[model samples]
Target chain A: MAGYSNDHIASLVRPDQVHRDVYEDPDLFDLEMDRIFGRSWVYVGHESQVPEPGDFFCTRVGLQPVVMSRHSDGTVYVVYNRCAHRGVKVVNEECGNVGRFMCMYHGWTYDTNGDLDFVTQSEGYPDLEFDKLEHGMGRVARWESHHGFVFANLSPDGPGLREWLGENSDFLDDVAVSAPDGEVEVTGGVHRYLYHGNWKMQVENLIDMYHPAYSHESSSAKGGQQFSRREGDKGGIQFFEKRGKVKSMDGLGTHALPNGHTWQGGLPPVENMSEDHRAYVALLEEKHGPNRTREILIKKRHNVIFYPNMAMQELNPHIRVIRPLAVDRTEIFIYPVKLKGAPEKMFRDQLINLNRTHSPTSLVQTDDVEAFTRAQEGMMTSGNEWVLLARTGPQESLESGRIRTTGTSEEGMRNHYRAWLEYMCADRPE
Target chain B: MTKNNRSGDNQSAFGELLFVREVEQFLFYEVGLLDDRRFEDWTDLFTEDGYYWAPAEINQPDPASGVSLFFDDVPMMRIRFARLRHPRVHSQIPPSRTSHSISNVTAKRSGTGDRVEVEARFQMLDYRPGHDQRAFGGKYEYVLSRGDGGRFRIASKKAVIINCDDVHLPVAVPF
Candidate 1:
């Protein structure tokens, strides 16, 4: 963090390439933890995670552990997990219902909404001006929820969450309306693991459709075939055989939205409607009518990367969150989502697909982890100074003020670096 | 060799000493098959409708409703075996070598049928080429039922890993 000046930081990212040092430098990683993750809107969790009052879920914004909680008045709060008194982590478990977080150290309490409640031996400090109101559990600077997915900004300055999200926010809407009641819930527990690689590798892999044919050849052949047979569609084999043929531009495409957000729109392998899927479609048809339902369900989207941390696969109904523990280590948390009013069978099937693709023993994801770690290892070999991001392909200026590129193009990566540079060079919050 | 009159009795019928030794030998044999990478022979130890489940959480029930670390019915297990044998699986290219140590085995009648539920603790050391060695320990619950010729076949095998929730290393092979 000490040696990285603005010019040095700016030199790492070019129009078509990035320096390998960005992925390896501890100081630069620390700088990103401060300048990028510290200022941007970091996704915390779904509102449904803490639906009732007094519920809290522990998460992280950058390297800082924070808790999202629901108060009695139906308000959600994103507070740093550290206690105001002794700086101890107030909530220990991953998630639970707590009336108030009482720090085990000295019995300092904070309400579910992150307001300071009581302190032990308060009267002893007579001359000390300890205002309890100012000493509550430290809350994130700015927080908001879009369609139940909550995000918090560590720095007070920046655009609102809606403006930051812009058109990319529709991805969440699509997921919500796909549910019968136009709502979704976070259920089925969490599957988390650590990869021995940089966080950006996983972030990039989220939208990179180029790897499946080669990296996941066996799984796509074996598991995909079984999955396709079950769906009674030409999904498994056709996906691998014709995957490369379907360029990022032609059949499906990518949209480089503002604020480093990117969306990959294409039919996923598991999009085929089974009986349960049909039932959910019927419910959607009744609720939103046929035309809107078709619009919602037909325009299939594989996943949406909200930059830095979250990637949501709407069709599969799960979110992959990346947390950078260190320059060489990253942790991932996958949460499967359930539509509120959808049939149990639909949610059940979604969980099955989620586990089959992304779990620890997943047929598809294990290879991706291998590639990421290998890439990390290769970068350290002193062979290449510049990593290429110049996948030339068809790109268009969209009417919606977004850029459309081939689904496999490195345009999304370039866009991400552009945003990263912008955030890094921006004026620091006072 | 014909039907015996001890069928309806308790420990007196199965004879606790013989039952314990038999189950221990069966588990040891199964371990050898897995360690030797004889996947097909290992798979044959299961009944036709058998399940191999490793829950994400320690006490997670019904993988259909929740996520699981590994849940394979008979056909799904076949697909896994086929995938493991494939030459191009990048994760398993050099393949994983495993050595297992199973102990603390105990068996009890399931109380509903002719099945005995066996419980044991297992520690497996997995070494994959070009990767660090991974050590995994867990409790194994196996329900065994007598099949044709009075041979025991696994109705279900559930592995509850102690560190399932911890940040896991790559799991290319079943624990």
Candidate 2:
């Protein structure tokens, strides 16, 4: 076995290069689950997912399967999915409205708030010191919300939600408050897909703007075929122009912001803007006035990685939560948000765009997944010892310990690596 | 369900029209164009402002607020077809082979001359290299318009998949 130290690992991460083992090592994956996932504020489910009393959605927080539920009084709660008696999962279904969760093995029931309501055969445990309050379902260390997006932390000692969010909080505010009523509801159900790559690979690709012009060239070309023909030009410009119209589809690459927040700029080309989108923007301006509507419309971002696991993309009204299942496999749960008061035509337009561009069967996204999966498979080989992150524009301004890079920079990936190292190397407080 | 009589009558008439063999023939022809990968011809079946929508939720009426699996207009649909048939498009290198079966045709007049709602159950088999053939079964809602030439043009094609919201492999083809 090769003896590795923090210093040795740190050497692999220069301003430009990273060790290949970071992507391939099983030991490193475990360290990530404990250090990164164990402490970061991981996104759970939106409040709308559990709107009704007793409505719950079961998902993962790190390696733990936790259920997010709404209580009788409308407060949302997150609890361990496992039962206390025999360790069986309390809820087997993905989502449902249930007054209480009963363990199948022993029939112990817990209320929506995760409080133990009753035990099977109460008379048999008369002399036992079983306390219903003490034996309730296990709750997460911390749970909070920014807008309606819910998140939880497994470690109790991490920073508060506001502090962790830092500059990204402003972006979150824009996402939430941009709506006409300043309230957003998850209108559509979630879209789930599996990536045969490391969870980090997906996160890295979220801000990697360079890949689309090449990897998604086919889809972009496909999109371009609808427009009038322009001679002597490969479809790259056409794809970029088309994608650049929507703020969400902006092909501007990565704009690294402070606090590990980054934005992809350049609206999809105006030429490709749908008639409905143009009309909707006009109507939004008419209703909310031009300035406010422009602020919402122009903040084009493909995906905003809120550090670690939560990624929000307003373009598709999509939010993806990454849960690492193994060293190589990652499960991404995608939630597509619906603008509550928007016109049916507008909503339909957005959905079609999302399915065609971002869905599992999307031409662009499938190629991306295939590339990442191949990367995961390739990293397993002993051929290369390090991965190169040394792309253009690594050094940029740092605000409050966060880094920012220009539009065509790889700083987002470096920022992610920096955070990864910080979490992985830091000694846990006992 | 609370029955609205006028709308119900319109719906029944529309359903009766859809059950006719001619309507089924029209649907079969449309599916054939798609299955044959004749994208340009497939797109000609839509009106200028027609929409193709596959919702992420079951029985979801509005598309504006919710994220849809797909909501494409004529231009977008044209682009999709172009890419699916593009040679440089690596994902389409082997190309996706699909077979669609449309059955259980039912139609209803939706209280408007411009609108006729036709419902059908469809099963699609899609195959590509290195992946198993994926089979999708769903109910289709086609809102059709009567063109000047007495042919039907799609106003809206809405597919409500049985596993609509589940995480799936990339959906490349129009369902």
For lDDT, the strongest prediction is 1
Residue B26, candidate 2: alpha-carbon lDDT: 81
> Runs in model 1 with CA error above 4 Å?
A221-226, A229-250, A268-272, B1-14, B111-113
Write one digit per residue (lDDT tens) for candidate 2, span A1-430.
Answer: 3445777667767777788878787777887788788888888888988889999999987788999999999999988888877789999998999988998988999999888888888788778776655688888888999887888998899689888887677777777655655667765555567776788898888888666666766655434333322111223334454445422232355666533556665444334555666665666787778888877777655458887887887665667788798878788776667666555565555555565556666646778887886788788778787788767654445555645445546778887887777777677778
Error of 1 at B161 (Å): 0.9
Q: What's the lDDT for residue A372 in model 1?
A: 86
DockQ of each: 0.60, 0.38
Fnat (0 to 1) per candidate: 0.67, 0.68
| Model 1 TM-score (2 dp) | 0.94
Please identify model 2 stretches exceeding 4 Å from their true place: A1-15, A25-27, A219-261, A264-303, A314-317, A337-349, A377-382, B1-28, B46-51, B62-65, B102-120, B141-157
The alpha-carbon RMSD over the true interface for every model, in angstroms, is: 1.8, 2.8
lDDT tens per residue, model 1, A337-361: 8889988877776777666777888
- Tens-digit per-residue lDDT, B1-175, candidate 1: 3346445455465588788888899998988888999888888989999988888886687787578887877877777778787778787878999998899999987776579999999998999988889899999999999888877899999999898778776787788
Per-model TM-score versus the true fold: 0.94, 0.80
